[model samples]
Target chain A: MKLKGYRRPDGRIGIRNHVLVLPCSLCASETARFTASLVDGAVYIPNQGGCAMVKKDLEITLEVLSGLAANPNVYGTVIIGNNCEGVQASLLAEKIREKTNKPLETVVIREAGGTIKAVELASRYAAQMSREAGMLEKEAFDISELILGTECGGSDPTSGLAANPVLGKVSDKLVELGATVILSETSELVGTEEVLAPRCKDEATKEKLLRIIRENEAHFERAGESLRFGNPSPGNKEGGLTTLEEKSLGCIHKAGESTIMDVYGYGEMIHSKGLVVMDTPGQDIASIAAMVAGGAQLVIFTTGRGTPTGNGIVPVIKITGNAETAQLMADNIDFDASSAITEGRDMEELAEGLFELAVQTVNGQKTKAESLGFNDMSLARECNFC
Target chain B: MYGCVKLHEKDTVATAILPITSGEEVHYRFGGQELTVKACTDVPVYHKLALVDLKKGDVVTKYGQKIGYALQDIPKGAHVHTHNLYSTMPKEASTQEE
Candidate 1:
């Protein structure tokens, strides 16, 4: 299907055209927000990890910041930071520049003597970029130019039976079209990594798949928690999932039967084609944010209970299989797959309907969450021990 | 089914498994027993159901494994939730008795 999408110089497709003001570190977050507020068309995300993070976490943070700048929806970026931080604004800006030569600017709060000076300087850059971003007209892009990110939140039994299976169908269809599909949330795939490995097209890919999952699980073990038992949060328990294994079984279904292409580290750019996995935390907001940071233009989210999560630059399509939830939270749910289970509706049909809706969303249809301004994206940072 | 909550054969309790309304009817087979329930109360999406009678401190199994224990005697078909049940597992256990 052909839909109007923004074509980035880096060959990425974007559903929205936005100018982003990014904070380099937590210390400069307020300044970035203030800068964005001064501009009518600019958006900024305030985060806690700009400095003091370990090497791996810092690299991930830098990658996320730079990838957001390279995101097709972002017309330009004005990176704001403290000069003393581990990741300097200039370095991050340079990295982003390497990815996309889009309008780039940077400001240092410490060098400018305070938040006020930094805000004034950053706002001037953001406003100019926003005006430039407004000048681009929408152009048609094919489905092959899209990268679909799949995720689920507020899972229940209907998750595996309906919502997730529907997503699996959608994922497989998208892969058949030669489009990229990202399936992350490694914690959610705990017991099912073995199931995922055989689907890899190569032995190397299979090893990477297992390695990615093991690394994430080991990280949790170091914290004295089994990711398997730790997830299915209190809310998930209240919603009926008993063990991590059961949850994993339901969660992995979202990937469908696509061959695994490659595995990416958190916040790392995915240049490979077809279905890939990212080593990501199971936290919905964090995982989705990481996918966006890695350059996913649109996100397809499935939920059994319901969630109001979204992204600033990318549009998130919210879907649910709980008929009552679809009715109760009509204002939140976008597509209804509950009928697949209750009415014995075909999953393929529901998936086709969802795919159509997702294409519509890419063509500028507002999702329930996006309409509600639920742009809750968070950068993932590996915890540190003091 | 969307809201057809079921318990494994070895489980002592079942869950709504999916979101259900106050008057919704859900059918499932558990412990070789085919049962149907008309929800008496508006149950939140994933709340548990008492599969069989259980006295205080009886193990509560879900997905065929122990998730927790009944803190008080829970009658058949009673809603099992945080108020009446607590995880007896090593991690995430509740200390207070109901």
Candidate 2:
């Protein structure tokens, strides 16, 4: 299927044309946020890790920051950093430049004199980039040019029974259409390696997928905890989810029935098309952030208990399968997929409508999350060994 | 419309889509067969209704797999939440127990 999107100079397709004001570390975050506030059409994200992070965490932080800027959804970027931070603004711009030829500018908080002066300098560039971004025209692009991210949060039994399965159908359809669809949440997928690994396209991909899930289990074991004994948050329990296996079985539904193409590390760029897996924490915002940084232009978040989380720089479509949560949190929920279980609606018909809504979203239709201006985000870290 | 929905034929429980009152008859369809069970108590919307008489320590199945074990003997069509069912599995999805 064809969808209308903005074609970046690097040939990537973006469903939204946003000028990003990125903060490389926490020190420059307020400056970046203020700068973004000074300009319309320019968005900023909070950064909590520009300095004093452990080596591995710093690397992840840098990758996530640069990747968010290089995401196809961003038309251009204005990077800001505290000069003392390890993630320098110029260095970050360079990283982004290596990924895309989009317009880029950098400002160092200290060198720009202070936060106020930095905000002024950064906003000037952001305003210019926003104006330039507005001048771009939407072009029709093939579905293969899209990277769709899938996630499930605040899950209950309805999520596993209906909502996720519905998203899985759409993921399968999108994969069949030759588009990229990501199945994330490695922590949640711990006990399902047998079920998921066999779907991998090749043995190498299977091995990679196995390693990530095993490593996650090992990580928890090291922390003297058990993922198997302590999952399905209280909200999930209240919503009828009884075990981690039950939750994982339902969470994987969003990947649909597509074969796994490959596996990627946290926030790494997803190059393989069709169905792929990403190594990310089960934390809602962190998982969404990893995929968005890895190039997912749009996100479909299925929540059974209900959540109003909107990932920064990506349009998140909030879907729920609980009839009461749908009506109770009507303003936050974009779609009520409860009929799948409530009335036993035809699965294909339900999925077709969701896919069409995705198409409309790709064409610039505002999701309830976007309309609410929610910008939830978080970066994953290996440890606090700094 | 059925008061509850069963996803798998083997599931020992069915999820209630609407609030079910005590002593109400809960009807659901499983593999083209309609079945009925009298609610033993009030079941909240989105909660599980016991599809079978479950004894304490009996593994309750949903989506055709063990979701949890009965904390106490649960009569057919009783509200099944944390009150009478709890997970005793070796692994879980959340970070820690609350």
Candidate 3:
């Protein structure tokens, strides 16, 4: 199917054209936010770390920041930084340049003489980028150019029975049309790893899936705990889930029945087509952030209870199967799959409707979360900072 | 109308599509036969209900996967929840029963 999108200079297609005002360190976040607020179509990401991060944490932060700048949705970036921070504005700008030939400008608070001067300089750059971005006309792109991310949060029985199965159907249709699907949340996959691993395209891929699951289990074991302690969270139990295994079974339904293609680490760019897995924690914001950083232009989130999480650049389409939650949280939810349970809506028909809505979203429809300005973001931390 | 959704043919438990009260006759299709079970206790919406008689220590299956174990002998129509079923895995001390 053909859909309208913005074609990036790097040959990638994006559903949204946004000028980003990015902070390179925590010290520059306020300046970045002020700069973005001044521009008509600019979005800013708050940097929560960068001053004293250890080697691994610093590397991950740099990758996530650069990835955000290079994401196809971003038309251009104005990076703001404190001159003496661990991550320099110039270095971050260079990293983004290495990935894409898009427009990039930098402002250092120290070099610009203070936060006021930095915001002023950065806002001017952001405004110019926003104007330039606004000038680009939308072009038609094939479905193959799209990378779709799947996630489930605030789950209940309906999640597995209705919402997730509906998502699975949509996921299958997208993969059949040659789009890439990213299934994440390694912690949620603990008990179902054996069931999912065999679906990998090759032995190596299968082994990688198994290894990640084992490592996740070991991570908890090392701390004298079990994954079950947190897998079926308090909300999950209240929603009627009992164990990690049961939750995993329900969670895996979001991937549909597609063959697993490749496995990637958190925030790693995905280049393969078909269904791939990203090793991410079960925390909703961090998991979605990794997928967005990995180049997913759109995300389909299934929630039995409901969530209002949305990414700054990529649009999050929230789907819920709980009939009551859908009606009660009408302002937060995007699609209601409750008909499958209450009104006996066919799974395939519900999936087709969802697919159509996704196309419409890609063609410029605003999701409920986007309209509400729910720009939630979080970077995955591997360990404590030094 | 109140109903229950059985996700898979192999599942021994079904989820309530709506709140079911004690003595309400809930009908479901099982193994190509239409069957009815009277709710022995109130089953809130989204909670589980036993589809068959379950003895203590019996594994309860939903979504065709193990969800928990029956903590007491449960009749076919009994409500299945923390009161009658508990997680087989070690529980987190932080998650006290609500």
Please give the distance, in angstroms, between residue A243's alpha carbon in candidate 3 and its true position after superposition. Answer: 5.4
For candidate 1, the per-residue lDDT at B98 reads: 27
| Share of reference contacts found in each model | 0.13, 0.43, 0.38
Record all residue pairs in model 3 with backbone atoms less than 3 Å apart, i.e. clashing: none
Error of 3 at A136 (Å): 1.0
Q: Note the DockQ of each predicted structure.
A: 0.10, 0.29, 0.29
How much DockQ does model 3 earn?
Answer: 0.29
Rank list by lDDT: 3, 2, 1
lDDT of 1 by residue, A308-373 (tens): 787877888878888888898888888899876565566667888998998888888888877876
Across residues B1-98, which tens digit of lDDT does each residue of candidate 2 receive?
77887876578988887789999988776555667889989988777889889999998887665666788899998988777776554444243233
Error of 2 at A249 (Å): 0.7
Q: Write the per-residue lDDT of candidate 2 for residues A220-331, one digit (tens) a residue.
A: 8888876655466667667666556566777887888789999998899888889999999988898899899999999999998899999658999988988999999998
The residue-level lDDT of candidate 2 at B1 comes to 71
True contacts kept of 1: 0.13
Model 1 alpha-carbon miss at residue A207, Å:
1.1
Q: Which stretches of candidate 2 lie over 4 Å from their true place?
A: A229-244, A384-386, B6-98
Is 1 or 2 the stronger prediction by TM-score? 2
Instruction: Locate the minimum summed-lDDT window of 10 residues in model 1 chain A.
Output: A238-247
- In model 3, which regions exceed 4 Å deviation? A222-224, A229-243, A384-386, B8-14, B18-98
